[model samples]
Target: MITDPELDGEWDTAERAEPAEPLAPRERAAAAAARPWLWALGGVVVASAVWAGGLYALGDRLAAPTVAYRATKNLCADFKAQSLSGITGDLRKRPVNKEVSHPAVDAAACVMNNVPDSPGDFYVYVNTELHKKADPATEFDVPSVDDLANVGDLRTEEVPDLGERAVMTSWAGEQGLNLKVLDGGAVFNLRVFATTFSEKGGRPATDSNAVQAAMVQDVRELMAALRK
Candidate 1:
């Protein structure tokens, strides 16, 4: 019989081809032992993904609301500090006022003094901040009055029914009272400094009870006006 060259080559190649080697008994057993662990690892990954997704969804739903407080150019106009003045005296003809409007925060500060052209011994400092991209509640708990003022026998107290949370810190002498409130993303800080100087010396003229009450009331009214 005569065979074509191409057909002869094809038959030779087919005869030399070998089958794939099967897994060894030891290798098969190892793979079998690893299967459960691999499956457990995959299950853990999926569970973690689901848990992370749930937290992300919950965070979105519970995130703080956008700042609704409308900060005015003149906080002095928004809050007259009448309650403070009721004890100190009539506020000077013109209370010092400053305003800042920015994308990140809207801020204003007002210094009301009874003495004209001077920092009155008895005066109230008011400041407000409406944060657009941050929540003041996170860092509001850190007390600030001690750092800023001469705090002698400092006393800190919690204020209820005012805002999301509020705190008032009082000191014996020059540092009278510091009231800070966090409502949504808005931060309201009011400080009352009262003192009287005579030939002998100077002593704190502030009535903690009365000043604390007035500060709370003024803060409430100020919060209301800003919300409006």
Candidate 2:
């Protein structure tokens, strides 16, 4: 029995306090290992943020190419396709044409139904796009087929001395040609289709070689006309 009440309370408090249990060896080791991983994860997050910020700052500069192409509404009247006139006859007074101008892109298209009176089917199409916002080089040469046009057997050939890159496409048993040219940020496409069943030889109105040559020649003139 203690005489002092204060001394007795102190003893009681000491008895009530149990020593805290130490963590298991495995738990301690796991905690130690996780500390480094947590730090690494934090570092990766910070680095990712910095990289994203940098990319956002350089987005426009990286995506846009240096080009001097201007949008024109007179693309239809500008291109005459004179070289093709011999095969498809003279151009009509009115050809279907469209033009669109936007901050990101400018587009112009012309479709001429040549030799309407004396031909079975004849068409000449020209389209030009000025990309003022993004580069079109990546997907330019990608292979694509038009199922609706029966273009499964379409073949492509490279044309030199035209632009940055040029490609001509033609299909088997088809008297037509598709030519695409890429110059800086400008994309140009020219297509010609002619099918006339002649009674004399039972052949198409235009041969493959003739169509190709005429398309190439007319496309050069078309490009020059648009540039002017």
Candidate 3:
């Protein structure tokens, strides 16, 4: 019934529509096969990245303990003297169990036991006296060379207390620093006994390398304070 050419073209739906070509079976199958593998590969990459990141984070936390041990070892090497004569007079006398005159020094002495024990059992002690001369206070005298040499028990093998798997020994030293290590609690099994003398007063010095090491170990601040 349409006479106009424009009207006739509009009325023919088939002329305006284009037919879609069917996808090849091979193409369709290839696309279907690739999708799952692509998703799986992406998942594996993500998992690997997460695992690597966790290890890096763990390593950072362990760094502090490692650094602390190294610092203590260095401190031992630095202040080691051939003879204990410098503080010998003060070391001979017995310690008076009193509150430490220098609390900071006492705290440092306590921390020595927390250091990891290796090679042999480690111990520390502090002895102190109160005097009006010096404000900061003084370290106890070191033992004489002869006395230190004579004392064989300074080594782990010589001391029976160290034989126990979890035995720690600590007492006040000639000055005001004392500490020791025993095998027990996570950290508490280790003990630190610190004494402080007035800069001019305290116990006489002794010649004991074990004692000297104890004093130096406490006051040395190579490592930061440990919580556990």
Best by lDDT: 1
TM-score of each: 0.74, 0.66, 0.27
Q: What is the lDDT of candidate 3?
A: 0.33
Model 2 misplacement above 4 A: 1-61, 117-120, 143-151, 197-206
* lDDT by residue for model 1 (1-228), tens: 778867776445545558878999999999899999999999999999999999998784456548878878889888877677676666646788999988888899988877767666677789999888667777887767454555456777899998999988877652478899998789999988776532112333556677788889989999998895
What is candidate 2's lDDT per residue for 119-169, written digit by digit as tens?
436678888988877887766876545423654667788998888899988
Pick the winner on lDDT between candidates 1 and 3: 1
Clashes of 2: 0
Better of 1 and 2 by lDDT: 1
Worst-scoring 10-residue span by lDDT in model 1: 197-206
Query: Which residue segments of model 1 deviate by more than 4 Å?
Result: 1-33, 54-58, 61-64, 145-152, 173-175, 197-206
Candidate with best TM-score: 1
User: Model 3, range 146-184, lDDT digits (tens) per residue?
Assistant: 335535433221123321121222223433222222211
